[model samples]
Target chain A: MLKKLLEFLILWIIWTLLTWSLALPDILAGVVVSAIAVLLFSDLFPAEIGRLLHPRRLFWGLVYLPVFFWQVVKSNFDVAYRVFHPTMPIRPGIVKVRTSLRSEIARTFLANSITLTPGTLTVDCVDDHLYIHWINIISEDPEEETRLIVEKFEKYLRKIFD
Target chain B: MSNLVIIFLSIGLFFNFAGCLGLIRFPDIYNRLQASTKCVTLGTIFILLAVVIHFGWNSISLKAILCVVFILLTSPTAAHAIARGSHRAGFPLWEGSIMDRYREDQEGETESAN
Candidate 1:
């Protein structure tokens, strides 16, 4: 299947990058390893390879990295400020927020993004609601919290996964 | 190039130090985990990025990128697991905490079922 080949190609690229060698044996080994990995883990991949291969989805995925990295930097600075402050202003609490993303991949991606960004950690997800431990409980309203926490990432993620 | 590397290195160190400060100063395990997870991850990634910049496109840089990828994937998951585990274990939140919607939701579900 094209999906399997795509998986193999991705794995092979990573393999080559890691090895960084053009020797015949290295290339042959990468091919073998990548093939085996694809065979074993194909089912773990997103079911709709067609959707994944869509140019729009690929473009959004590429765009997501810089946006995510920028947020990470911002969050680090925010947390650093909180950590170094004399009073250590924090109002931590668990707030539940709803997510519109239907796919498992999208939901997981959102959760990971929330956790990676400073000031929030996803405690749990049940049904469409995610329980997040926020460093500063800005608002208890689920809709408001969702807007504050999930909106920025979800737009790009929806494009990529949903 | 050397100056760029020093800048990255210092920024990384600063963030790492902030994370350590957070661990000490934050009230509870959950908050501490948040600090450790986010700050340390960014710090490590920056340090790795610095390595990549210094090494150009060789195997070392590639390995650094791989490490960044692995950290990005694993650290948050690990933090989530720990936070969830601690919550389930009834690790108390800070005294200044305001809400616990998770417990309220669970209680509501049980009440409706009963």
Candidate 2:
């Protein structure tokens, strides 16, 4: 099946990257390992592989990297400033925010992204609601918080995963 | 190229130092975890990125990129697990804290149960 081949290709690419050699023995070993992995994990891949392979989705995924990187840098500076400030200003709290992302992968990705970026850490996700611990609780409204925390990442992630 | 690598290294070091400072100064375990997780993740990724930039496109660079990817995926998950564990263990927040939605949610559930 197509999913099996996709899995095999992904695994083989990782193996090649790990070994970093194209010699005959290495290639043969990689092929064998990748094929076995595909067989073992065939059920894990989503039934609809077409979405994953879509050109627009792939492009948006690539676009997301730099945006994420920039946010990381900005957040590093923000945390650094807060740490050094004499007042040690922070309004830490857990706020409930709802996410529209339906897929588990997308929700997980959003949570991870929130944790990695400025002033927010995902405490839990129950149903569609995410309890996020905010170092600086700017807005109490869940809708506003969702906009501040999840919207930026969700647009691209929805394309990639949903 | 070397200058860029030095810049990256310096930025990484600064972030790492900030993370340590945060760990010492933050009021509670959860806040400390937040500071340490984000700073360390960004710091480590920048350091690995510097390695890639310095080495160019080769085996070592590829491996460095792989490490970056793995760290990106694992660090936040680890932080989330620690935060959740400590919260479940009833870790106290700082005195100046603004909200406790998790506790409220639990209370709500119990009230409904009754």
Error of 2 at B105 (Å): 1.2
Segments of candidate 1 deviating more than 4 angstroms: A1-16, A19-43, B107-114
Q: DockQ of candidates 1 onward, in order?
A: 0.61, 0.60
Looking at candidate 2, what TM-score does chain B attain? 0.90
lDDT of 1 by residue, A1-162 (tens): 888988899889889888888899999999999999888989998776567778889999999999999889888998899999999989998888889999988898899999988689998877788889999987878889999999999999999999
Alpha-carbon shift of residue A52 in model 2 (angstroms): 1.4
- Which 10 consecutive positions of candidate 2 chain B have the poorest summed lDDT? B105-114
TM-score of 2: 0.86
What is the lDDT, from 0 to 100, of the residue B76 in candidate 1? 91
Tell me candidate 2's fraction of native contacts, as a decimal between 0 and 1. 0.75
How displaced is residue B44 in candidate 2, in Å? 1.1
Shares of reference contacts reproduced by the candidates, in order, are 0.78, 0.75
lDDT, model 2, position B76: 90
lDDT of 2 by residue, B2-85 (tens): 999999998888899999999999999888988998898888888998999999988999999998989999999998888887
